[model samples]
Target chain A: MSQQLAVGIDIGGTNTVFGIVDRRGNILYDGKMSTKAHGDITSFLNELKERLDVLIDKVGGKDNIRGIGVGAPNGNYYTGTIDYAPNLRWRGIIPLANLLQDYFDVPAVLTNDANAAAIGEMTYGAARGMKDFITITLGTGVGSGIVANGQLIYGHDGFAGELGHCIVIPGGRVHAGTGMRGSLESYASATGVMLTALEFMDSRPEQDSMLRHTPRELVDSKVIFEAAKQGDPLAIEVYEYTGMVLGAALANFVMFSSPEAIVLFGGLTKAGDMIMRPVRHHMEINLLPIFQNKVKLVFSELKESDAAILGASALAWEMKTDQKAETPQP
Target chain B: MSQQLAVGIDIGGTNTVFGIVDRRGNILYDGKMSTKAHGDITSFLNELKERLDVLIDKVGGKDNIRGIGVGAPNGNYYTGTIDYAPNLRWRGIIPLANLLQDYFDVPAVLTNDANAAAIGEMTYGAARGMKDFITITLGTGVGSGIVANGQLIYGHDGFAGELGHCIVIPGGRVHAGTGMRGSLESYASATGVMLTALEFMDSRPEQDSMLRHTPRELVDSKVIFEAAKQGDPLAIEVYEYTGMVLGAALANFVMFSSPEAIVLFGGLTKAGDMIMRPVRHHMEINLLPIFQNKVKLVFSELKESDAAILGASALAWEMKTDQKAETPQP
Candidate 1:
């Protein structure tokens, strides 16, 4: 099975996605299953193993299966485990890859989904040739993958590149996960976008904005984008405000990584220019003269739905390549 | 004069300072001269060169010198030039290292002052053992120096670490230099801090704050710090607001470099915990749970006056060490 094929798996709080991917970023086979209903991680692994076995059979009897790569919410590359992940109600260190490898008798590796996305972008998405860049997902929550010097920074404990949490405003707003006020996520996530629109509605109750017509809980970004597309003022401001916060956060990242570009990916970002224009405007207005025209903001080419899986798969390939390169192969 | 001691020159907008430094980060001798009150930069270089010869002879004489490291406002390491610098009234690139090297009969290297500070931190200051960290200075303007994967990122045009220009707010308020709006500098730099104080003052004209005693044009951070120390609510809020902005920017940086720490230097940082506490609180509030309790936001150990000289000397020492390390032995 050496150098034959690798399984790329991206595990989330709600769903588990695994794909048989080759060295060239091609998906040979794939499957989806729910990540254990409770904290029963072992059960989740067992289910994954069963599904992988089926995929192996579908791909001609598993003769070419070499290893597996897993991208999880809180996977730690250095420790070869996942720490307390709030989403899955998991605590302590879970030797996820090792446990799964025991069942399949093959090499297994893992990394955080953010780092995986970074590797995916480097290998196949918007930042393909750039040495430095950041990829952000404005999904249920915001996710950031930072790439510097053409390599993902795992930091001292493989817990680096947490871009979504940085506060854009201190004492200015509130976020669900963090107790602090004015985090970038507070202003720019899917929920954050709605909050912004909701706050705008609250501020101008007398104004005849379309958001006033929408219920608070029923209010979502898709509806907001639809309104913006149809010339809704408040809807447009939400995207602009999101872009402003995102742009500010990104400018700070640009300072640190000096990335040539930043790729935006996520469900909220499907609005495209409605989002990018404000982010760019703020970035331009905020950047110093030297970085004025040097960096660019781009959209990820990978499908928003499949990007996580592709990114996770890329991480596995990258880890294997690094190990092979450094192991003094005979 | 072939082996005369290497010169470490620190050039600024107002004055030019040069010193003969050895490979050990020690300044053997030094002197300064006015950098021409009016037009042209050649006069400054010629005067600097003449003074350097005098200092060099008084120390170890000409043969002891080997090279020169020029730290300037817009010096470029790769090109060995100083491009246009707005503060210096210079508007074109000059082969500064070449011009000095030929004159001193020694190799001359060049880099921006902030970069020199970063290298200085790497060689002789707080960041000596670290490979990833960011250094921010709150001075006339916000400036940053970045070290990634143990090497400084000069970026595409040696402009990679420009943190001052990234917009923190887009079209919300405050103008920034980089054609953007609401940059970190708009609310964090010394000037930025004062701007906030001024705005705060406008809404509280009758307050008996110590800040009211100081004239507007003559106002500086020292006055604000003194007022805060004297229990001035306005001054205290100014400091808090400044920290809020800085914390947000640092959080932004956390997402990108994921540095172990961010070191703050310069005058305004004299506020100490008044600034650090809020920034830490804000940063914590904004960071993702995975990145929590990991990143350190601390102060720089280097003094403002001695920092430039020490950093410049350290920069030379670094170049000397690397060049010596790379040279073929007999």
Candidate 2:
């Protein structure tokens, strides 16, 4: 019998990446396309289908394929819809999973990218065998997935884990996407880091920093990381402030769920100890005595380049397992 | 066979209430004793057993009893221990459930008072047939119990749902117990309300208020409630401020679990719309657009006088159901 495969699709603002993965976490075949180029959902679906057909044929068509799993912004697992993703061009709710399932002639599942990352971590990364842990994706914006008793907390609605939006510095900084002040995403994400660097440089006129010389458009998380690594005091302080905010938020999460560990992922993690050090410090300091020094804070073990596709793929595998449990054996 | 009954015990700082209850929420027999009068655990246990035996006899004794359930401060559900409860005379972890089981020759289950309250609400109160909800107990101190997907979030360490300790204002107010600053409990409890009233009076020395005429010792939640009802501006502002802080914290929690409802219980709920109006207003304002009006924030339906005992009793029923699942019938 041919080996069963699942298709994983990761929809980002700029690009979309899809991969055909086997049950064992191997990416057998992969492709990419421009998300912004397809102005409408129909055009995006058609382009995705046309590109995926060649890969599906190579892997013995739809019969050998188990299902498709999609990781998208503001994705809803229960309804399998993308409900008004701020970063995406799609307005209102799009029945993306239904569209995918119909086009592929197979079942498809969908959840927010962070949730997908959490499942990926549980299946094949740092959170392996840890029943209660949280996966945080610190990218352009912060996203999170909370797991308790080995099941993702989907809550009453499908949008349970929105840690980024949890008000940390109540009435502090306004987010461009949410318009809410003092959210974790305002200071913890890559964009937040850049904003902090600019704010610090502006606030302290006499502070000598490499960031001051760099063009505003050119400065990003990577540049800040490099500057911090080179011992720029201003760049280092930016991470210290960011980590402090992130850590305090994490401490609140710890008290809420008492997870065994909190796994960090995405672009902001590249700062390594620069962010991790203060995050560890502030998180422990803010925690109640019982929860202090207990939760393991670590980075994702999955290769960042492939983590998205793998995370999305893990959902398909889970869906297949659920289906088997529902259907009685002959 | 005689109808099955369970024993429920609620251990408070001042008093310990115990009752025999049937599955249908009927209080068959009940009694109370001074929790502090018995200075030690052994003495407390002996007095408790002696008082409970008479109630058991009235209900046909041992054979008819299903099990025992207990609710107390610092209670650990998994270990059946009460670890270092500040209010109680007990200094360290007390194996209350194991002791009860040995003395009564029946199973005994234990959880924190708030968790027990949540179970009670689900079993026989306003949260009946609801799968997702949170119960916030606003007594001397704030306490919370979180239920998601029909199960309490025990977390990895059986210490989940400590929403009271979740920081609302970073470095804002100091908690007498945990010494943590800006925790929800520090601002949302009955004690918090009293503290707010005192602070308001102190800050506005010339402001005409009835509270100024009343002695400091006479000030409490009930007094504040009465003052607010009588249209005292200072007292009314106290509720508004407390509710604003609480409402913001509730919004953070709503973002975490997206619970269908948030049930308020204990002393503070007596203030009614005085507190509820600001809480509803601030909670809605802080929430992201998707989560704004979806959650139903209501008062718990359980009668406060019998709630403690009823909540503990509900745990016994749940324990029996769990045991039945584990051990198959002939």
Candidate 3:
């Protein structure tokens, strides 16, 4: 817990991961525990606190901790609060950072998991060498973190990078964030891919797809991706459709941000070519007249823990460095 | 002749508008001339040259003119060129600013029209008091100028702020600009609105709609707005659809740039409430959780001439003043 080591916590819908990371992006000690299934907000924090106490005790105490950084669903960096994240049962606004700060007796910060990924990319992942780019996490839902002019655009508050919910199909399907129908998340997200696969199978039963042998509950995007790699039309179609949506949405992103590159992260993106080819093809086709030839789509090259932890740490690191630099050396 | 006035030219697909203006956002002289359908690029410049000669003569010879500021499609501020506007029938890059500089024997500058409008708004219009905002023009296509931290976001190659072509409705419609289908332009642009309106009227063939009498050639969003105001369900639907698309796109924009406001311009947006109501309703709803209670969406208050001309002039002013400020003067 020395001030040289910062605590990095990645609070997910299912698990809460905590670590002591140094300025060099090294995790010295780490621990994890199950999140409250009942969505009991205080109970969840109490459990995390108990685990953190063990880690702190091993490191000689809380006074040694410089700061705490949290990567969470619906987390806001500027406000340090978590809004309604359905995956977690917590309701209303939770002062996540403040809660951690109070229990740990150290400065703490919290931001969306995706924003943390972007920062992680900038500091330790595929986008490490870049100053301006977007990091997209193709997870349960599509989450993106944007870096422009070497800073995260927290946008008046901290909800600037909700890329998944932008309407990709205006009247297509009901999306979660916007309550609008047919967002990119509706068609390209992992769940969306599974839905497409099910529909494809139901609509075209004659297709001898490998996915036909997979159980319904286990019929997620990974099986579809594997089937596509082995040349299954139905599975390939799922990737194609997902890529098309991603490409179209990415093209729009290019017009707005003009970032140097776009890096994809998370499980769904692990399909790589199965996901990228269509995205690139469609992205190139839909980009602005001038932006057509520029901009590259690539995959994130960071460990999951690295992106989330580093990104969360970036929030505190950037803030601390900026503050320190601005303190006016007498 | 004097530094007080410069000739500002904005060349669009159909018309080439030229104006003589001073330091203030005032047009002392202005004229509109057709770009002359399909001709040599030099001929267009010659025609402009001849016009400038007459103006110089009117101002007691060439010494009375300061320089020139040109706003053209595909104009690159970094390169001082107009690089192929498809509708202009100019298929290659042309050193537009250099050509004018050579002709007038003084300084000249060039940039894309959207950027010009941004400068115009920043220096003299609704955004005069703001430093971070975006100006979106919903004409035949969607055009945008981004102002971030008090400067335009021209990325490494100077091609940034292509807001209209960003994907709002992925796979919704095949659109211009990169041939990516279903962009913001395809749904929210004037051309996009026309497509949506036609689709709207067709969707409700049996409805009591005023669009029944609207001529195809003269048909536009205005007719739809007037009808929507008069309680036409179909027309209201059109506006609602357009605004929702705009709002959804704006939410993404807010995430990327975190601008103070988004200022709407151009013909399609003139429908005012017809366009804004939906955009606001949808944008506010889908906004990043943090931006939910904050962020403002507004319309431009600058006349085209005032904003465009001023924007063009401001480009030149930025260049010349930047040079002056950098020069080691005794």
Best by DockQ: 2
Steric collisions counted per model: 22, 0, 16
Candidate 3's DockQ is 0.40
Per DockQ, what order, best first? 2, 3, 1
Supply the DockQ value of model 1.
0.39
| Every model's DockQ | 0.39, 0.77, 0.40
Better of 1 and 2 by lDDT: 2
Q: Give i-RMS (Å) per prediction.
A: 2.8, 0.8, 2.6
CAPRI level of candidate 3: acceptable
Q: What is the TM-score of chain B alone in each candidate?
A: 0.90, 0.94, 0.90
Model 1's CAPRI class?
A: acceptable
| Per-residue lDDT of model 1, residues A135-254, tens digit only | 887888878877766667766556777777766665678776767667777888888888888888989887677766777788888788888999898899889888887776676666
lDDT, candidate 2, at B21: 91
Candidate 3 C-alpha lDDT tens digits along A92-161:
8887777776777778877888888888778766777675688888887888888776766565445667
In order, what is each prediction's RMSD in angstroms? 5.0, 3.3, 5.7
Cα misplacement distance, residue A227 of candidate 2 (Å) = 1.1
Residue A52 error, candidate 3, Å: 5.6
Q: Pick the candidate with the highest TM-score.
A: 2
Better of 1 and 2 by TM-score: 2
